[model samples]
Target: MKFKTSLIALSIAAAITPSLVTAEESDIEVITVTSSRMDKPVSAIPNTVTIIDREQLEQQFRTTKDLSTIIGNLAPSFSPSRQKMSNTGETLRGRPPLIMIDGVPQSNPLRSGGRSGQTIDPAMIERIEIIHGANAMHGLGAQGGIINYITKKATGDNEHQVSFDVTMPNNLESDGISFGTSYSFSGESDQLDMIGSVSYRNNGVYYDANDQMIGVDTTQGESMDSQSADFFIKLGHNFDESRLELMVNHYNMENNGDYMAVTGDKENDIPTGAIKQEQPWEAANNQVTTTSLTYTHEDIAGQQLHLQFFNQNFEAVYGGGCWSDFYDPSMEGNDQVTVCGTGDNGESLYYEQSRNKSVKWGMKASMIANNIAESGINLAYGIDMFRDTTEQDMVVSGASWVPESTYENIAPFAQLDYDLIENLTLSGGVRYEYAKLKVNDYKTMYGYGDKEIQGGSPDFNETLFNIGASYQINPSIRLYTSFNQGFGMPDIGRVLRDGDSFPDENPSIDDSLALTPIVTDNIEFGADYQGEYFTAKIAFYRSSTDYGSRMVEKEDGSGSFVVKREKSVIDGLESNITAYIGDYDDVGVNIAIQNGEYDSNDDQSVDTDLDGANISPNRINLFWTHNFDNDISTRVQANFFMDKNFKDASDEVYSSFDGYTTVDASVAIPVYSGTLSVGIQNLLNEDYYTYYSQTVGKDTRYFKGMGRTATIGFTMPF
Candidate 1:
């Protein structure tokens, strides 16, 4: 009864439920030792951790295949889904997180493509691990935390599945119809194991509650009116004292909609819309391929050894623009006509688009040693090295927007765990990072006057530390605290490409504002209680930095995004609890509340509150899952976003956002030969603007969330 808080039960909503961390076993033990950076029980780790296992993933899959939606509902701190391919406004802990796939980094930190969250399909994933807080354990770009998607593993028994799914809005319009199919297999023979999967999905056009066409996000890319495919393969072999594994994955998505955006009037509350029309440029697209090889050896001179090598290749093309000073030439069935928006033959409105391409390669090695000479102590150490080359260019104009930049980094880290008392463990770790970025001279595109900027080589050296202690109060409860530091670099590409920012007097990257490396310090206190019929976890955290980059819209009215570095602080509380209602039913509630502000004018005072693009709104969620006779199961979830207002304490722009609530439900039944599934998203058909569109207050980007939707799926195991 350590978690008896009856007074708050009336306001209870569930972000953590049976759909999130459902363990078949009742004993509290190590869930998984893969993504913690160290092999230990979560109770021994001093930081708050969130683990989503396959059962949870499967439950979400029955509703929708959107990765962001699945994560947003499972984790309280995650931002609401933009319902798009680009993760522009998706921030974790009011900051960007380093996303990885089975130990391979997928985030393009050098350039902001905003496609890191969609690198892999959920069908190929077995579980997800999220380490909440600022830390350098992953070596770079983990300002908020680390999210690792662990791939499925091959079991001793050979098994396979084939599935087909379809989703659409409640109206059942043809344009709202979407479909997908996938096949996966796991096989093992003696010491060899293998797993493979291929999946494809074509998303239909989206619609709001009013049955109006949702505006397309041509600038950052969109999930509506798009088609995507994913393929993955993994192989492993076990030897007497060593093991080896290889993994490869390829994914691509492209929009082929013949439509144009219709800007709206936010003041009058007219949401953005879309119409059928010929587009001026190539459709937006994204493609990614990753490869990794890993080796492990046990009892290597009394230490466990592990090594990994990985490579990632990525490319994306954005939608064409129709703004002033941008030349428009590629109109379908028309010559290179520049007449765009009130311009005649003589007056040309310059319209252009860009593409992002990057390649990353890296290697990591770590070793673990325990109880040296029979002492009650343990240690783990590792080293990581990586190099990335990235560039952006106008797809049609053949002009470089951002010069090719190569980043090289090498970091070594070590962690020690010591038992200070019978029930208390002290842990400490430190990492040193050495990085160099080399950029060549390049010219900015139209709008900034096509200015030529000189590029220089910038290098950084940083030492980061993390220390924590966990004390077990009893068999069912534990308390912990931690202090950690994280190192991050803003995408210099944004600064280099901004022709308007470079003055006529200066032309070098060395003196560029907002180009400094960001180092954040974070502290947290947490407690966890695990019982047979009740479970609860809660954490309070605060992070601050004298200088750090925050994402913001460009003030030049180009409808582009940029980064601003200033003093900022963020503090929040996250908690979750689950109570078994009976033998086959469970109900739960969870809440996420955070506040963030920054020194907008660089005066060193955090006076202005952060916008929705940087921080998620406070949320309360309720969820319940029940099992019935004949192995049938059902789940229902409801999430509410609390309204918020920003106080103008500084010179930055301010706006208020109204909140809304949405519900989702799903059920599974055993059919003749397979499982039949059905789900309803936004079951109440609530109509509302997204957090970003409401808070940013830009007419062109003001958009509404999705309306009610229904999906059906069937799974056949062979």
Candidate 2:
């Protein structure tokens, strides 16, 4: 591959030219370990790493643009874009992880069934790295670990840029807008380089916490709107010295309000009486598309190389028609009768329509080798491939409910790394997977008879593994450990099931969607510190599973949504810190913590004890950033989310999520040259709710988490 991209551009210009001429004369590269495979430097990489720089996302963007809590200020009750029911559901250490951009593999396991919730739009991020555990060279779907997004590239400087943001709120007379523009060019001696960008966002309407108007399934009056458009392009070249690149990205989102599910009880006549649709107030719509290609090469003789390719496609269409499934006092005023009629009975209904589509493609290759003689040894290697597909159609045409399904998958991987000495490091990895599924009924193909006589065709295969170690006790300390094995498969809408004789023959119904495939075994340990004024990390974990996807009890206590492959276990701990309290170079502070449990037992029958499953065992974060002397600046952030006394493996019942603490603060100054800021979010006024059994069932009260919110902005870099 162009001689390993000229030996990784001569080993990253010989290890970054004396650390870029001593980074302002000392310290400024505390940690970074691109999930191992020899990018080594998170204290030699034994696991557990998180780096989100760019001045903490521009000081947390002042107040809120809902970066889904931006890692809960720094790990604590994370809600990576919470729209619940997977409107980009995200979690790490506490489950659901694996997200990458620059290295490809941008999760979309055929739509939310492959485990990693997908949603990208963090203003084309420039930095964000997390490794945690179980890498398996980022293949076969990482089991709760990995989130790498490093964008914004193209630098040869021939610039032109622009950015804009508008937000106003204080009792809803609303306003929210975003705009962007960019352009770049280079050719001093024809090393070639190019860049492009465009953006637009409307994003308005969100108010909850008794201020009302943030409804969807709870129907407390209504509102929620979103619109988006984004585009990007980049190209780079520099032969001989080695360097090649290409990129393209596109995004589109359109969401209107009011569309909720889980309907079942309206005095239950068997129509929609168990509905769990939260936030439903009345309108619906969704879309995404992306593309990418990258290549890197430098210092061939000493080794270093990288290549990546990517593709993404997404589509969503929800039914609209002022939908309401129930509320008929025997035609007390009849509005065309409406009597819909179906299963979870809110008086039985049909034809609410549905559409879902997803596609992903990726490829990756890397190699790094430096100073291999004198036994100082250093090496790195990697390989990966992916393909995912999903298509679901639940159109009832004239009212028949549920039909159409298809899912497919393909995966491949490889990895190896050996530092041997100098801080000590060793690693290994592997992965392989193939899958296929199909279902068609078209109402039994034409005659509208035989609709579904047990449709068939389900196939899957899998394999994955990993191993690791790291040690270093000098130059500021380091320690590491690892053990891994992960797997996942199942998502064609979880293999659509639930049908048993309505107008014809039945064979004792209950197919239970024949599910299986979800295995994990993770064990990790960590520590890395670089003191001169703090830079820390801590990790401890245990994950066990024999198969996942639960909720299946029915002997009366009610529950049906099967996928109980049995066995479940999770134990955890995570920590983070970034200090530098004095010396005025710009004071700083950051913190993080997480806890976990779900120690076995969950045979569906709900639950009665052994709680701690709804995640978030404990979390607390604190932040402070200051720099005032000419270009004034200030920031203060805090977060605390605790609880998860959760239980109900099937009817054991126990739920919890009460612990709460929120605080936010911000300030920035630098006019003319651009930059003006303000902040105040969730400063007390705490009234909460976020309990789910798949979309808000027992408690669906929300308040937009915008309690004391206030923001103002401006930016420039010419």
RMSD, one per candidate, in order? 2.9, 23.6
Cα lDDT, model 1, residue 465: 93
Q: What is the C-alpha lDDT of each candidate?
A: 0.82, 0.51
Q: Which predicted model would earn the best lDDT?
A: 1
* Model 1 per-residue lDDT tens digits across residues 205-233: 98888888888888788889889999999
Query: Per-residue CA lDDT of candidate 2, range 1-718, in tens?
Result: 0123443332222100001011121443445555565566545555666666666777776676445466546544344244322433345554555676666665655345322333455666666766654455666456666767777766666665555666544464553222223333332337667766666656555443444333343222121355666676667777886777787766655554423433433222112111223223223334566677767787767778877778777655554322332222233334433344434434433233345666777677777776567455555655566666565543333332334444455556555557676767777666676655555543332212333545555667777777778877776657778887766643334334333222346421123334445667788876655556554555567766555543333343322233344555556656554455564332222333343334245443322332332243355565667787787778776665555455453544354555566777778888887777776666554544332322233223232333344566666657
TM match of model 1 to true structure: 0.95
